[model samples]
Target: MSKETLTIEVSWPASLAVPEGSTIDIQLWAGNDKAGYSMIDGDFSTPATASPVTLEIPYDSQDLQSHDGTTTWDHFHTSPRLVHGGFIKNIAYAEKISVAQTKGAAWKMALR
Candidate 1:
């Protein structure tokens, strides 16, 4: 996979509910602290029962993910890929990112 191919498609089942009082989000990464990307496009806190929302993330070096009210990617070797991620609160308690894909000339992801 090339740098351009570092795309991720995240979806949740329509039947299941996002954990009550919590939210779900997605992150796309080139590498830790390497200007990754993320977005929360769904009403994960209040999902619909009919259709599973699909979020097509368009990420790149230019559209880097950031915290602290910024769009820049997280800091080098940052604890959270997002600097000011609201989910940081969640990360304080649980694992938000379970799988991650590293994009380069070749691709690899978190193992099962």
Candidate 2:
């Protein structure tokens, strides 16, 4: 069993008002047919320039093995009210991800 790191990049609209050094909480969920589910939460700081922020999350071998080759993941911001929400469909393990909020207050999720 080998462990793998899942990297998720979250972005904010330039027009959005995000104060610098604000705490952003990310809630992530990954699940497969056999593994049932796994959840991880992390916090990151908003860069002064609103550049894309990245988060690295680690999953153990057991979790990876239980994935059954394909997995589905969803993530969203849990604080600061900056981002609305987002989700991803069937994907092979984890890859570079980018999440952002639309101007109309809707959230979007994508794999980068």
TM-score of candidate 1 versus the correct structure, residues matched by position:
0.26
lDDT at 92, model 2: 22
Writing each residue's lDDT as its tens digit, candidate 2 over 39-100 gives 54344333324545555555554542224656434322222223322222112223222222
Backbone clashes, candidate 2: 0
State, as a TM-score between 0 and 1, how close model 2 is to the true structure: 0.46
Task: Encode model 1's per-residue lDDT on 15-104: one tens digit a residue.
Answer: 433444433333334223333345422222312222332333334444344444355443212121111225422221112222233233
RMSD to the true structure for each prediction, in A, is 9.8, 10.9
Candidate 2 wrong stretches, greater than 4 Å = 33-36, 41-49, 64-112
lDDT of 2 at 77: 25
What is the C-alpha local distance difference test score of each model?
Answer: 0.30, 0.39
TM-score of every model versus the real structure: 0.26, 0.46
